[model samples]
Target: MREFDYDLFVIGGGSGGVRAARVAAGETGAKVGLAEESRYGGTCVIRGCVPKKLMVFASEFSGLSEDAGLYGWDVTGGAFDWGRFSTRLNGELDRLEGVYRKLLSASGVDTFDCRATLKDPHTVSLANGEEKTAKHILVATGGRPVRPDMNNADLGMVSDDIFHQETLPKSILIVGGGYIACEFACILHGLGVEVTLYYRGAQILRGFDEEARGLIAESMRERGIDLHIGTNIVEMDCAGSDDSDTGMGGPIQDTGETVGDSGMSHRGRQSGDTSDGPIRVKATNGSSRVFDRVLFATGRRPNTDGMGLEELGVKLGRGGQIEVDAYSQTAVPSIYAIGDVTDRVNLTPVAIREGMAFVETVFKGNPTPVDHALIPSAVFTQPELGTVGMNEEDAREQEEIDVYCTSFRPMQTAFIGKPDRVLMKLIVSKANRKVLGCHIVAPNAGEMIQLAGIAIKMGATKEDFDRTVAVHPTMSEEIVTMRNPVRSA
Candidate 1:
């Protein structure tokens, strides 16, 4: 057999790639090499999860100050300094990136600061014109935010660009109904930006529980976010251009230009000025407006372009996601993939888990298949939502379910005369009494669901939760105290 330069080659310095490389090299003493074209920490640490959560924490203070005033404290709200916060946030991310690099180096994994692509099944080519071969190759390039293919789409910024903005916009128009859009809408609104949200769908957060989403929508509106449902941006142009003069009154005409088979558009030439000016937007709901900035949190696509995977006969989905088996192995037995590139449960923690599983399966001689079910997730809106397992809508479709739900004003907000309400729902399987789902919509819902997730994951039933004693004077106590089912279907 031909000797390869390394035992395993990981292309991508993101969480999955880094984890797999470090573990395989450190634990199994494999000759591992990894490459990262961009920042080492990937999306979650660099721009996606960490920085976003910091902004969420900053956004909460505005409300906290108001509640403090109600508690007889002379509290006052101050102006938000985006520059200071952004600087601090960037410094923290840089520190984290250094930590990731240190971990890889300590594990004896050869790190390449350049891009890596496949030369063949066994050979990897780096951007620095170096080619090295490995016994096994792993792809974990991850994904990128996608903008809609409309007129002047490039004029709008994606989620990744939000971190790099020099200053927060005075007013912003956020498009899309997903968690990203809603979270930013709330975050920016809290930071004193005149925020407006437009979702083409009838409601935001389409896949979540209906009751939970309904309350979120109500809270967002109450918090002064101008939300428009069943609407989308048909055209966008820079202010003070010929295209910008298009009347604000009629519904936007459909371009009829279909998205190609690749599900992405060849980015069109940008029109109008690209300076610091308002952007003119015409919506499908027959309205026109100009905003300081437009953010397209529309969606994301797998980062599998121009990697030579297709030519190598690796099966790819329509979205450019790498097709892999339970073992994360591709058709080419020596090749494997994990994380968002595989498009399996696109969460940061899930990617890390998949990476660990990949290392165990390939190097440790323990065949491990990644578990993708019942993963806990949270959306950091004004009133956050945390969920695990199947939602009520999906659970009812699969089996007979009894939903035990409660929505009431929490003690903290009720005491302050704030109209904030919380929701706790448990979807129980009627036949087996197993808790099919646990969904919480409240402040600190994310923290609450982490513990609740453990029970539901262990096949906890309604009786199991009921038997547990309640924590007094707490919102979570309702999860254990609700005895009867609200409805069954």
Candidate 2:
């Protein structure tokens, strides 16, 4: 008789969990079972990356007509039908969730479409009170968007709520300066909505290269994003409520509609609720305004709450992230965790790689450790920002470095008299000549950085980049042509 019902059972049917379960069951021939309380593809497919990128694409069209006009084409912009786009977007998400299910089924992995929590180190208890035993268990429960702790804070929408928004608001107050906040700020602005962003920090994109982030902030302000630094929400309430008074003068004029029940007021516009009016907000700067919606892009936390993890002796970080070793093994040898649950490199690709590493270690006996260094990331703001390796600020603090940087208006929009600028910068180590970082801020910067990431990952040096011939009339050619170090630190 088998000692356990399955060889491996995964909790959380996300990219990491699904990848690990499929590989272990199909390739390694291990009996596997997986469970997810929500959609199978988790945040990336359902909410975070895929849907938001589509929104970025939809939002980009709002500015194309003017650029096209400069190119001698009489293309005029048209109204954006959120209904049509959202319908298609939701359809796409449904298809993706189905694909995730099909992949697991084809791999011969058993999948339970319900929440599963740890009953013990090797035992999982499903929401239906069914118990499943496995020789090894992997937790990939992903992260979730969280609202700030404040009165009436529930009135604001989180990143997950964006996909379900049936209609776009006329004006939105996006709180936070992270990539999520900035991306949506640009996105909504492009979609013809008034976007006001408030971040209680000196600058947006705080940890990125200073020069790159500065340029992005400049471009965003130029593009009409009402961005305010060192600003945050002091109080918020549904427009016209008795407690919605802003000490600036008096309460914002009520539109004669009462606040809807629960969180429905935020999404009430979807149902064309006349009673659902804008949200009144008072800022730290002693300003008062009402926005059709208030989006809190502050942060995310790992989905480890009430999972019975701490009871099983699994170490959880301050952020509720499951603490695991190099091989993704927990304090209890039978339990393992990966993906956002581990909170190490929270990108989708990193989670998938961690899942693969977990399978290699626990199932194949190879004991592979997760390698997280030199990971490339992109902020999908207007013009986009793609970066790989250390930022200039961090690199200089660690060791001596040479920074080769260039900023210019690219030819594509330059001829049109558009002030759209792009930046290409490389940070090189003084001692080893290795390119420590590459940062690009321009159109399709995300795509350009992926190619550059390969060279940097292989330890390509500044001379190696210089020796490569420049492709003429190309902005990227500057990567190879720049010879002198603009600055060293």
Candidate 3:
């Protein structure tokens, strides 16, 4: 019933918006408002990070079941309840949503659990037609899945839709080659499902260090995942005879060449459904297989649609992410945006930093630009991939870089007798011997990279890494004792 609602208004209850609202409310003791159409915690908490990590753990643990004997544990034929796993995932997400809500409320920020449409730089209208006016506004609405229209009529779903899936697929064909695709590939393959990952590019994990990418690929194959690189989907329709209505997958090809025998040969032909019957899919390489489900983890774009940003004249770049400067300020001076919406280093922690920076510049009278360098990230593949700083390829492309790297099978594998190897790489500026990039692919690489990130942020050099003695019998020590530095002219 308050006529004038808040001093600060935040749209999109994702990471950036939430952080800004919380800090602004707590520090300034100002009445802050936040609005979210979806469940709180944004993509990272609800979909991207939390649920994905859980799925990865489920997948990895299934593999651990096989390696349990090596760790002195025995396992008979054990059953896994996909339903239980999915239920637990949902519970964790719910708990996280509750925690996010509590944080906002406890910090004295009022939240509107509805969509926020900007009426002006200062005014936002909610779904219930309730309007709030503020001195400043921030938008942090995150991205969503871009579903393919051609593959639409089939039973396949995108990365976002897979978490709440009703049934665990016996076999799944995941299309696309980005992190989301690769991450889910690790998850499904770890879950013991027959998984075939298709990437349109030559390599799966692009932008990471090449050696780490190779290592992850090798581990994936060792774990029995079928990776189809340089493959694509051309057309899809439902598999059914005498029924022209539904969609089916046709044939799958590799590099424009047919590979395997069509498994749907026995289904018989149907009118308007091609020679293959219903529930059929066709790959560009001309090989066809019937899968229980198809998944696409291609990539993500910014979520600047339908929230009335066009009317407000918000400019977007690089897949519709709002363009912002150092202080997270958009073109419109009074309006601000951060997090995935800004598309600058689309990580949760990065968003939080930008949010805090916004508050400092606006309310605290001190300005700091968002620094993305040395931001550590992890890809939870088996023998998990972690990185802070630049990899050799990116470093070379960006600057004159000297590279040092090593690959060794972990010692645990020496006892358990698995041949899968861990690969680590460092990119140092040849001009200054600065440790600009650190990359690793190994078990717990994500956790291991944290220390490396701190070192890199502290301006550690290759010599600094070498000056530190190597810790024996651990996979992480490769970072310190990189002997040969490969210089790129």
Q: Rank the candidates by TM-score, best first.
A: 1, 2, 3
User: How high is the CA lDDT of each candidate model?
Assistant: 0.85, 0.84, 0.74
lDDT of 3 at 212: 82
Minimal lDDT window, size 10, model 2: 255-264
Flag the better candidate by lDDT, 2 or 3: 2
lDDT of 1 at 123: 93
Off by over 4 Å in 3: 1-4, 149-154, 241-278, 486-489
Span of 10 residues, lowest total lDDT, candidate 3: 257-266
Residue 465: error of model 2 in Å?
0.4
Please give the distance, in angstroms, between residue 436's alpha carbon in candidate 1 and its true position after superposition: 0.2
* Candidate 1, number of clashes: 0
TM-score of every model? 0.94, 0.93, 0.90
Write one digit per residue (lDDT tens) for candidate 2, span 1-489: 659999999998878889999999999999999988878788888777888899999999987898888888999788999999999998998999899999999999998988888989889999988999999999888777666767676677877777777788999998888888889899999998999998888888878899999999999999999999888888887888887343333221211110000100112222222224689898889998999998878777778888899998999999888899999999989999888777777888888899899989888989899999998888999889999999999999999999999999999888889899999999999999999999999888998899999999999999999999999898888889999999999
Encode model 1's per-residue lDDT on 1-489: one tens digit a residue: 899999999988877888999999999999999988878878788868888899999988877777898899998878999999999998999999999999999999998888778879999999999998999999988887776766576677777777887888999998888888899999999888999998888888888899999999999999999999888887788877897455343332211111001111112222222336789888888888999998877777777888899889899998888999999999899999988888878888888888899999989999999998889989999899999998899999999999999999999889989888999999999999999999999999999999999998899999999999999999999999999999999
Question: Which structure among the candidates has the greatest TM-score?
Answer: 1
